[model samples]
Target chain A: MNFSSKILEDAVNEMSQLPGVGKRTALRFVLHLMRQPEQQTDQLSTALTRMRHDLKFCKKCHNVSDGDLCEICSSPKRDETIVCVVEDIRDVMAIENTSQYRGLYHVLGGKISPMDGIGPQDLKVRSLVERIKKDGVQEIIFALSPTIEGDTTNFYIFKQLEGIDIRTSTIARGIAVGDELEFADEVTLGRSIAQRVPYESSIKN
Target chain B: MNFSSKILEDAVNEMSQLPGVGKRTALRFVLHLMRQPEQQTDQLSTALTRMRHDLKFCKKCHNVSDGDLCEICSSPKRDETIVCVVEDIRDVMAIENTSQYRGLYHVLGGKISPMDGIGPQDLKVRSLVERIKKDGVQEIIFALSPTIEGDTTNFYIFKQLEGIDIRTSTIARGIAVGDELEFADEVTLGRSIAQRVPYESSIKN
Candidate 1:
């Protein structure tokens, strides 16, 4: 009874690794895939491989870019005097969709969590500091998540940039508590950016 | 080394056939599956083979059942005279989820289509007509989609039931014109069932 086609079992094995996927789900998902047009499956495989290969971190901002300098960092239309700091490239895309923030972005690549063994130096913090110093950026906004790790990273960043001639702020507290920036609906994320508050103001309180 | 995994590739090929998945997606899906705990994959494989093997169409209403009759069709609690005719078992599950419907169901297997060469006889229409006559049903509700094929099937069934004591009706008109019954939201589907108008009355208008 256990004898089944090996490829299906093998495909099912690989599918089970995705976030939220279990073995049963992997089988169903694989079966669902089996019913589609051949080209559709090919396209999905290409997209996944391309997502891994074609995309690279921009040298300037650490955001995903096809080139050395990310599009936003390299674009002349962007405001070099203001930099928005975020956890990942998705955050950069989230901010770009608002059409409200014309400033550039610096992706930290990840948050600082001592418990998980992640530290500030392990992130792109050095590059962000370098960008602020050389690009003549007057404002550096910490648009990182509001988690404990996020807060720790934000303050660590703030202390690093304290001597620099730039101001620092964060997106407002209006976002639902425990909300990650990624899942915030466009309207909520936009409103939060619009209502950004001074980083030191929160620190003093 | 073109030692590319053959079983993995064949599994991906099979998965790429699903409704929305492509080969690329199938590869990722298969890769995800490959990473699962071994027994989990084994159980999933068992379920896939079992779903096809253990499940059989009920002789009374054509819905997938383990034995001669499905749960709803066999249950003494259901309204036997009030039959809801649907495209397949998915529709049966959809109606069952609401817990509001008390009528037994007749799964037509599929709708009529000249292009596909599927006609009334190709479906379980003859079985449905036989059940209607044998059961002396008082009401027959057509719950097919709003497509031309579904309409054609409904009209064909309506004509077949002529001179019977049954009152023929189709699910109401407000549902989006071309949507299948499988995709409609529960509220819309339930409302359609509740507001069903008489077939003769709609045809007259």
Candidate 2:
């Protein structure tokens, strides 16, 4: 490959890195751009630059936000007392679209996976515990995935919330193996939230 | 759905209109945007607006160009006499990537598909004929697709150049049905260019 060809190849490589874009698809995309009016090409470049510069994580929920907090966190319409604990902001968004649960959310950043070197300390477990102890939260629902790591994270949270009178629950319905919450359809997501079960039996207490 | 939910649904609908994005994928994309750091979301909106304002086509080659002519058509290194005719600017970029051809290009805008309501005059065919006759060109290679519309377009152009002495040809080999030029591998594209086959001989004397 010559110098110019290398540049074209580099462009294709960068494009293929985006989600759902393979080599052939990347090539097709780049060719589409080349076919577009000059304005369209500029739009994509400017969009990337702007996205890198302007986006920030919400200080409260860790979701993407324009200001100090996310739109959901700031909205008065949400049930602030019922907080849904999730692994990431994508989960927050997923639940939002379902219109199933009208409550606030707490993004954990990620699950507790010690094998990948991620532990309870690495997640927002501390923040979550702090939020529960400090705020007047009535129910803390674990809306995390059904994976082993997700289960471990849920248990870890369950242990910490033991003494509190507030209800501790996990979204107990309709999550499949290795399938992400972000991909769940509205019907399934709605059903799961509606059918949440208590995390503890509290035998003979 | 409430009024706000309706707006969100429309946003998803707009995204799903793109070639590969389905409703599920569209929902994912919209939810991603709703969760976007305000900056990224704003950037996407801004980019869409800016593109509509800034992009335009080059008058000479009809490829997307910032200036009056596309970079390839304006470059001094490209051969003026050998004009490679294509269906769109995307096809132009594909041939340019081969780096084996230094010739200029003429975009036909689209193929001649009567069933789809596209005709010769509807394309850049007349302008191509004019360019060849006025510029005293030696060759015009048909780099359009191998489909029915592509064949129709090819025959239409051949008839238009009936009186001209200039040699007209196409990239000779290594492409299959439903194969897009953008997806073909580099080696295959190179071989196709090398094996140039002549069209039906003897135009009007």
Candidate 3:
């Protein structure tokens, strides 16, 4: 779109660089910023810049942190021996929100997607393996998404741990809670049936 | 959502202030920025801050401009006597893209919506009237949205120009060019039928 001011155009172009944001949406965002008080724009810019420059990744899990280690890694109560391997920090946050998992997380940064030119090396896989070895992690949970890339990354990491004496497992794949059985995808349904837990065990959980 | 880092949380919170962006989307944006090079974040922050701080509105038309007068108002090719009044700079850009209207534009910044606590006094109504009187503008075209607020704004401006000898008209309200007749709303269809043009004039245009 034709912008009347060069400054406005530059702002819109920069904003549109964001994932999923289009030029029109960026323009709307810029206009919204213009309508708001100057302090709002200043605050937004300062926060983003500060976050980018000052934020540190947890050395243990690769999750965003204020220091070398994330809150989960620094906490004494969390089960450090059982590390949940996931694609990114978002997944860590998602599991944390559930309040079901007390174990620590190892953010993979990304999965092995050959199509996107992202391999095991591009992710935090090496760091995770080193962490497992150094920390004497007993159980490694493959909590990545049930996609081809997710499976590839999980298998790659699992292969790397061939000689390590650790219990390896994947998160359960089944019909989501409150979802109808018929709505579950075929692969998930089939897997759920194949890995059916005993009635007593299910009830106990 | 539970954020591990305070800097990340602040960035997400500030980004979420943009229209239609929620906490989840904000987190995505923040994460995407984090993945990019530091230069990308710096450019985005700088562009937005500079735009908000340095952008200027045209003295003549109120459209965003680098100088005192907008390009449209300053152009010698544009007809100074006929002005198309619009809600904002976006409307100005939309009309300019059409390339059919050679007249100048007068931006009202917003419509008269009592529900939103916006009135004629809150808009550039007075400045528009003063402009028409001072510039000897012979015609005023209302190119606002076909909404109650738009119509009220138009009527308010019309009342302000009571004694002025200026011709007034509104942009046509009809079925969109590529829209099916069956899908056209009743109000637009009725107005199109009531304000039917001569067959010769319609075909000529």
Note the B-chain TM-score for every model. Answer: 0.81, 0.79, 0.95
A1-205: candidate 3 lDDT, tens digit per residue: 8787899999999999999999989999999999999999999999999999999999889899999999999999998889999988999999999898999899988899999998877888888888889998999999999999889888999999999999999999988888999888999999999998889888754
Candidate 2 residues lying further than 4 Å off, grouped into runs, are: A1-17, A22-80, A96-102, A115-117, A173-205, B1-18, B22-56, B74-77, B173-205
- How many collisions between residues are there in candidate 1? 34
Comparing to the true complex, what docking class would candidate 1 get? incorrect
Put down candidate 1 lDDT per residue, B30-124, tens digits, no spaces.
54544455454445444444443444567888765667777677788999889999996557766776676799888887899999988888888
What tens-digit string does per-residue lDDT give for candidate 2 at A36-61?
57555554555444444555566777
The DockQ leader among the candidates is 3
TM-score (all chains, Cα) for each model: 0.48, 0.66, 0.96
DockQ-best of 2 and 3 = 3
Q: Output the better candidate (1/2) by DockQ.
A: 2
Model 1 stretches with alpha carbons more than 4 Å out: A1-3, A175-205, B1-205
State which docking tier applies to candidate 3.
Answer: high
TM-score of 3: 0.96
Q: Please give the ranking of all candidate structures by lDDT, highest first, separated by commas.
A: 3, 1, 2
| Ranking of models by TM-score | 3, 2, 1
